[model samples]
Target: MIPTSKPHNPNFSSGPCSKRPGYELTQLDISTLGRSHRSDIGKSALQQAIEQTKSLLKIPADYKVGIVPASDTGAMEMMLWSLLGKKPVDVCYWESFGKGWFSDIKNQLQLSDVNPLTADYGQLPDLTLTNPDHDIVFTWNGTTSGVKVANADWISEQRSGLTICDATSAVFAMPMDWEKLDVTTFSWQKVLGGEGAHGMIILSPAAVERLESYTPPWPLPKIFRLTQNSKLIEGIFTGATINTPSMLCVADYLDALNWITEIGGVDAAIARSENNLAILTNFVNQHEWINFLAERVEQRSNTSVCLRLSLTDKQLKEFGQLLADQQVAYDINSYKDAPSGLRIWCGATVEAANVELLLPWLSWAYESVKNSD
Candidate 1:
């Protein structure tokens, strides 16, 4: 039997995740709607977002945080196209997003000294293989397979290379060491559950130096240009967007940021996500057929909580659909490249109590499917 009460919020998609609890469209008005983003009102809102991100993430004092175009992908690619090839690169991967980067470095940039460090899904590559002299690119969390880099201890503080991280899904939901990372990027669509199409890029002093001193061989599009005539663009860091932005989306993000402050800040957000993961962990511990996609407990993502099931691909798809059919869950299907099973977003916005309620529904769907088969 399906549970009588549903999750207070049923949005579990990994991207553009459920907005903060009590979110309403009315809460997002900032009096800048339909105004040019270059205007004072629009620029003030944009700069507020940059400052808000810095306040919540506690970025390094010397780092420059800028709002960029095309979500996380755009911010990352801009850095890649603008900064790579100055040194050898050590690209690491454990899942689909990592593979995409690998392709870009190999096929797109075609760097001569690129070294591929890889591992199967649900596992991690050897961190020690990254050469200090080589620029490194990696995703801090694998959204598809639900595995994340445990920490940044493997990185050397004295390394010459810039450690660029695509931390879209992990930020605000996990602990990050600013001292260890040189460049990091994330979109508003993930942990904060804000609108998409805009990305935030944080650059340490070393990263800013690279942009000012060295330029890649490739031609940078207008959207990807970060430096001009040997100087970093100061205006972009202060909320001068490269293109027109959705004022409504910007307002929504501001609302989410304010909610983050109300809910005890970043540490509180991490604890909430961890608590949600704990609730799901306890349920998974009792289920024999369902297991974590990430083999190592330490590597498991508390946000994008992926699971591997004993059922076949078709069975898993049907199960995912059944849960959605009953309005018990939504968008719980495995990622396209991952083994078929379930992927649940247990990010900060997800209440632990809602996770607890969803457990019995899992049992209901599983049993009903098994009996039907």
Candidate 2:
């Protein structure tokens, strides 16, 4: 029988994910909204975001975290413009976002001695291909394909080059090996379920050293510049942003962080997502028509859960629309670039009960679409 109970919250978008459980707009204190970001009132809000982020992630004591303009893309570009081209480079990519970094080095920077290590959408590349002495770039999680690197064991103990990672989708849900990563960038929208348009750039001591010691040949834009006269800008990591920021978004992020505390901390947050994925796992296993995109258990993501349904291209499109119209799920369609199927956000903010409610609806939608066709 079709399930009668429905998920109270149907927001499953990967980027701007669902907010914390029982989230309300009234919880945000927008006292700094109308004030300038550089003013003391605004800096206090910005400072809270930076410090709280460090605490929740358990980032290294020595690392520096800075707020940058745009979202994750802007923070990643800032690292490439400021720190790349100092040495030979190796880029590893399994999905679209990782491929974007490869293009940046090849087409945009036109850097010499660049090597690309790639694999199909569902699998990871050869981590051994990177040279320890050469700068390496990769994404910790393949968001579009719902695959993520299991761990950071491949990195050497004392590598000369930086290990830059686009970890927008992996930060809170996955346990990060902070020592293995030299430069990591993530957006506020992912696991935290906050507003976008602001990005956080995390720098290890090595990344900071690269910024201070080596200067790239390309002229750095004002927005991308992290150093002044060979010294790292200490102010950016300490509440002094390069440009104006929306304090409303900042306040909302603060509220989200506070909710993380109330929800039994980050471990509980990860557990919520794990439980959601587990529910989906059982559902997919029982149904012969649907299977996980990531073949290996280790590579499967707990955040963006991608599935391959047994259906034609035309049928899958109609099926997704049917699910949406039924008010059971929204944006369960796969990414545009990937194979046709379904992708669900199981981030920390998503309620496991909601994900449980979603699976039976999937079965209902599949049958309805097939019979109608």
Alpha-carbon TM-score of each model against the true structure? 0.98, 0.98
lDDT for each residue of candidate 2 in 210-263, tens digit (9 for 90 to 100): 899998998988999899999998999999998887889899889988988788
- Give the winner by TM-score: 1
Which parts of model 1 are misplaced by more than 4 Å? 371-373
lDDT of the candidates, in the order given: 0.91, 0.89
Number of colliding residue pairs in each model? 0, 0
lDDT of 1 at 326: 75
Residue-level lDDT of model 1, residues 207-304, one tens digit each, is: 99999999788888999998889999999999998888899999999999999999889999999999999998999999998899899999999999
TM for candidate 2 is: 0.98
The prediction achieving the highest lDDT against the true structure is: 1
